[model samples]
Target: MAAGPGRYSKRVRRQQDILQILAQEPTMRVKALAARLEVTTETIRRDLEELAEQGLISRTYGGAMLRAEAEPALSQRERELVKEREAIARSAFRQCAHGKTFMIGSGATTAILAKRLAFELRNVTVIAHSFAVAMALAQNPTIRIIMAPGIYHAGEGAMHGAQTIRFLQDYAADWAILGASALSPDGPSDALFEAADVYGTMLRQASHNMIVADHSKFDRMATARYAQWSEIETLVSDRRPEGPLMRALERREVQFILAEG
Candidate 1:
């Protein structure tokens, strides 16, 4: 006997169930999905083709895998963190003086500071690992732009590798402005190990260290710790630290600035 419309609806629900399962385990095979959903292998193949067309997942030789680059891009991240990023950038800019050489790390907050500095500061030199930061400051003939070469990570929008480390070794700056994924009583941390290495190198190459981060980063932990609270000369954040964080920084004698937007 032929199947009714209800059977077609059931097949659609099974396809959705397969997608959810694949999301959790991206390496699931068509045969496995068919077995799990009690459907033919042909049905699973058709579902996989539709999902691939929608850019929801990628098909491999024998299975499917999630796209590493499928997450939100840097521009999207900037939009989400706009208010806090502006606050942090303003606070960092306040510390800048005319004709000072500064090193900046790659992140949305630092990108904003670079734009502000390009228009506001005069005769300043900026050493940056971010293509975005370099491009932002490039139009100003008065500002000297130095780009560090390395393997570019598009997600972080920065260049990083052994070459970047070697280049930074011979460079020195009056101040280093950086951003972090997380901040705690101990200090700044980052999601990537290579990023932590880069931030540490930037801190070492500068006479003074400043970190720009939003309040949302406070009390969170990441894969790697870049520096301790003692290493940071100042922290520019959108909101004032409260409770344990405030008390901890006070105990450590770390300078803190609250940026009002």
Candidate 2:
């Protein structure tokens, strides 16, 4: 008999979990993958075969690994990872009650969260450095928008510089909702130096700090390491982190929220 829809869904999730694991460690043997995911080695072998056929992963003698690729532009990134980012945005939106104020940072995921807040939240205030973020929240007339002053980065569609950092210091918010170019054991980092500085300042200006990222960012490092693990209050992502990164977050007592689509 054919597998049920539920079983097929489970297999898909398991395959994604395998990809996420490889993203962290670069490679994994079938035996180790089965043990980590709590499935049979034969199951893992079949999954690897499917993944390899899909060209999402490369197959080795007894394992699978991620193919190395350079980072894409901001426009490209926003178009990629649509489902994962939407799930992350939904999970992060739960923290935004009607009357709370937030310091929102720039990124594809954060923009999605802003759109969610605009649609579902009322009487909220958002202080943001990104033009895209501001425009997204502007859709809701009830939500007040405060755009930071700084040098505009056309590529990122965001504001960054000393002006933005200094402006953030003057106000406090309930939460700082941000995104990461890369999230590693060291913490969340960004590719832009000025943007990293702005994010770090936002973290300080808020009572609680939350990062919205996808599994693709796991175990990756960028140009600037913005905040230490302890500085972040929560992480909402498509998958729960594993290995040393999980241990690091646990040691710092960061809340890990898994977003289910």
Candidate 3:
């Protein structure tokens, strides 16, 4: 998992903490991290070095900065944060109403939820543009899978274009379960510009909206700001968000559900 619970190794937790800190601030020095984390400067330095090597951060002299990684392909993302995403997917399954239609978005977490829904929910209808989501939902003979038509995106394994948006206009769903590239105080954003439009349309086409993301996305920025906090009804994640992001969600009255690992 990318950032699991406290059960993870101390080194992994500390490294994740460093990334979390960097997410709130632009950059942090090794000395500052050592002081904040109550560890030796050498330990902080080593952590920063490892994070840089992993391409998750950039070493800047004695400090480190968050690296703006391009959106990874769906397959690559599916291989990361497996446990965390699964936990979130299971928690999100409770929100699925039996015999209801849902507008699902494309992402590793949403795809996982699709699989769970296939096993748990009966007589449900799912409208999605993602190949992974459709294939997963197809496992249940009782659940109806509606695929949106559009130009297929190889990187995302989803369909996105004007055609997709136009197709969604013809139908509405009881819930819109979407995934996000990043979640900041501003709102949830998407790394891929092409997919963001489709997600926004899904939100508009559904009566309620829920965003499924893990803690790794907190305080991070992305290429497209898809929806405002007021537009979202719920956020399902593996960990509780802290600081400004939490305050923003509270102020906006967005429900926050921490998925137990």
Q: Tell me the spans in candidate 2 whose CA falls farther than 4 Å from its real position.
A: 1-70
Candidate 1's C-alpha runs over 4 A off are 1-72
Instruction: Name the lDDT value of residue 256 in candidate 1.
Output: 92
Which 10-residue window in model 1 sums to the lowest lDDT? Answer: 64-73
lDDT winner between 2 and 3, please give it: 3
Taken over the whole model, the C-alpha lDDT of each candidate is 0.79, 0.86, 0.88
RMSD of 2: 10.7
Report the lDDT of model 1 for residue 175: 90
Indicate which candidate wins on TM-score: 3
Worst ten in a row by lDDT for model 3: 1-10
Best by lDDT: 3
Given candidate 3, what's the lDDT at residue 44? 92
Error of model 1, residue 88, in angstroms: 2.2
Sort order, lDDT high to low: 3, 2, 1
For residues 1-261, what per-residue lDDT tens digits would candidate 3 score against the true structure? 575655358889899999989977745778989999999999899898898888787666678767656778999999999999999999888876553999999999999999999988888889999999999999999998899999999999999999999999999999999999988777888988878899999999998889999988886667788998989999999999886679889999999999987
- Kindly give the number of clashing pairs for every candidate: 0, 0, 0
